[model samples]
Every structure is written in structure tokens, then in C-alpha cells.
Target: EDFVGHRNGAEEFVIITTLSFGPPLHDALTRRLTEELHSFYNFMERDQGYVLIEDGSGKQSQKPLMSAHITVSQGEPDPNAQPSKAASTSDDPWVDASEDQDQKPDSSKPSGSAFDW
Candidate 1:
């Protein structure tokens, strides 16, 4: 995913990778995979995302378990930004950096992550 950021010029663009996972989620094994999804792919706020479960034939059935639209930005979201009535902040899986940060200037924490589920 590539998009112009808050930067003044269109020349300044952010490029992030997106990965679509299909089939079998939220279960114990799937939870581990989800962590790897965060560890390996490393999706950011600007990135697009998708999740669908595969059928017995190993093909996606066109149903989404998660989506980029649901994963709110970790960066400064617009004050007016609000989740739709059907979706609340609690439903979002992405954790904000602010919640886990330490007061020290050099607090030990990863600079990037897809986010913890």
C-alpha cells in the first residue's frame, strides 16, 4: 500500500506491504499465526488488509473476518474520526503505541508492528 502522507508534497509517499490471510482464525493455532502476521508482514495504519476463511477445498468463500477499514490508524486520527455504530473501538485489534509506551526517552519497545491482537 502506498499513499501520500501528511507531508506537504505528493512526492512524499509511504509504502507499506499488505498480506491477506485466508481461512481458520481466532482459534489457538490461528492466534499464533495472527501474531506471526504481526511479526512478519508488519502492517501499518496506511496499509490495506483483508481476512477471509477458506472452505474445505482451500478456497476463499468471499467472507471477511477482518479488514483495513476496521483497523483504525495508530497515528493521529482526526478528532472527528469515529467508528460507525456497528463497529466500536473495542472491536479493533490494533493497539495504540501510546498505551504501551514508557516515560523514558529510550524506552525499549519495537518501532514497528502489525499490532498485537
Candidate 2:
């Protein structure tokens, strides 16, 4: 459901994504999600940057959504660096709740699509 465009007969192309959510998230979660979305959108909308919102409207069609035009500079790759994973973040209530229960994971069992955290 994603499509990228190549324009001006150049090697550079713009990336377009279609993000979907199966269910509506609560307002408490919206702030974090919206901030992350803006961060990602801004990164992609930088100099040599391109942005287009062909169909951005969604559950909140009445509200206006902002488009970004940012300039990003790529930094040299770090071999020892690691990317942050949301599931491992401190903000995850699920992880905290599970920790409170103090139940260790059953490593012997195979994981499935609808397994617990």
C-alpha cells in the first residue's frame, strides 16, 4: 500500500507511506504517537526533501493536519550504536504490568500471533 515516486528523471526518489491502525488509540497514547509521527514525517520532509498528503484525512477528518518541509543532514554511521525499540521503552505500561505480576516467560513454548507479552 506504499508507493514512492521518482521525479525530474533523477536518481533520487521520494518515499510515500500508508500507515494504518486497526483500532482507535486512547488520548493518553495519542500524544506519544502523534509526537513520534511528527518526528518521522519531519525527518522525511527535509531538504532534497519532498512531501505530499494525497489522502491524510482519517478518523478526525474535521481537524487539519500539518505537512512538513525540513532539512535533514545524515550523520556518519556508528558501528556501536543501537536503535531504540518502543517495546523496550519505559513508557510501555504493558511491560510494567507484566513485571509487577513477576511471571517469567516460558521460553520452551513457541510464540504465536496472539501470544501474551
Candidate 3:
């Protein structure tokens, strides 16, 4: 299916491309989150019965779906877990193009496949 292919392509691109670092990485993440949120809102708008609770005070209010999900916190990593191979190997998380040339089938084309976002 087209969706599966595109998802695989995205995963491949992330694994092979060095944009995993710095601003480009954050920007890509932001865009993905925004798209997901848009989809969630569209889904919520279609169903009239679904209501999200805004607070612990047991108040029944029609608040935007985003308000109920706005608070985010980073999860602490497990201290006992072993470091991944990539993390253990180098200080830089960016993947070197030379490290795995065969990961990409077409060297002439841009690393990430064409995407509107």
C-alpha cells in the first residue's frame, strides 16, 4: 500500500539522513506533531457525542481538544539500561553518509523523499 511504502521510506530516510541533529530535527518533529493534531481535531469535530474533560474539578465544558492534551513532560530514561551502539560509539548522534552507503538506493537523489511538510 502507498501509506506503508511512505512510512517505510520515512523510516529509511530518518535512519540514513543526518538531519536527526539540531534545528532540522526539531522542525521536522514539530511539523509531524502539528499534522497529527490537525487529524485529531478533524476526527473530534466529526463526532458530536465525544467530550473531553478540561479539569479535575468535574466541570462539564466544551473545550477544544488541544486544551486537554497541552501539558507535556519528558520521561526519564531508565538508568540501568545499556547505551545503544550509536550512542556508545560517538559523541555526535548524526549518522555519517560514509558509514552506510548502501542504506540508500539512490545516491543522486535527495536524502529525504519529497514531502509537502
Candidate 4:
């Protein structure tokens, strides 16, 4: 049996599929298709911004597998938009204190719990 699904958006579509076969063949087929799908996704994400692969080979070692492809388009930002302001010195102190707090949990609270929780 075969199954397919997809989602829609302004610039792209995603398609996924699954196929079934006997246990031995299914395992092998699934493994191969899964590897191919991973490679395909990497290529699409890096090169084409899309993915396309066939799903399922009914070999005795194959299992169920899913495949997908996509297309992406780059959009330009507004030229007239104002650039964001740089953070002031006050903001820097808050950021530094936040990092210090993260490194050291509050000793006033019990070891496992937070003050609010």
C-alpha cells in the first residue's frame, strides 16, 4: 500500500509518502529510502531549497519509508525600512546579569525547584 500527504503555503509545498512490504524486503527498502531521503533533504535545503524522492522499494529487507521534496523562493526586504537601533549600555548590563543568573541557580530556592514554580 502507498500513502501521501502535503501542506500548502505562499511559496512552497511539502510532500510526504509511505509504502509497505514484507518484513525482510521492507527493512532493506526502508533503510535505503530513508538514507536517500536524508541526503535529498540536505541537498534541497542547501542547494535547491526543495526536496524530491521516490518512496518504497519492495525488497525483502525493506521496511516502510517516507520521502519528500520542496521548492523555496527568496524574497527581498523593504528598502525603505528603518534600521534597528544599537543597544545602549544599560541593556548590556541586563544581558550580562542574565548570563550570570543562568550559570548560578538561585540559592534562596530549594535545589530542585524555582521560586515561581
C-alpha local distance difference test of each model: 0.36, 0.41, 0.43, 0.41
Q: Where does candidate 3 have its weakest 10-residue lDDT segment?
A: 1-10
Q: What TM-score do all the candidates reach, one by one?
A: 0.18, 0.18, 0.27, 0.21
Supply the global lDDT for candidate 1: 0.36
lDDT of 4 at 71: 34
Q: Compute the lDDT of residue 86 as modeled in candidate 4.
A: 62
Worst 10 residues of 4 by lDDT: 5-14
Model 3 Cα shift for residue 95 (angstroms): 25
Q: Report residue 16 deviation for candidate 4 (angstroms).
A: 24
Tens-digit lDDT string for candidate 4 (15-106): 22332233444566667866765553455353554334334664333222235333333345699999987665445433333234334444
C-alpha RMSD by candidate, in order:
17.9, 20.3, 15.6, 21.1
Worst 10 residues of 2 by lDDT: 18-27
- Weakest 10 consecutive residues, lDDT, candidate 1? 6-15
Scored against the true structure, residue 103 in model 4 reaches a CA lDDT of 48
Across residues 1-112, which tens digit of lDDT does each residue of candidate 1 receive? Answer: 4332322211122323233221222244456755644554335421434444476799875432231221223244488988765533355433233443333332243333
Judged by lDDT, which candidate is best? Answer: 3
lDDT of 3 by residue, 10-101 (tens): 32322222322435645676678667655655565635534464556887676444321122223455999998755532444344545633
lDDT of 2 by residue, 35-107 (tens): 7545644554643244553444533222223332332233455989899676642444333332454354445
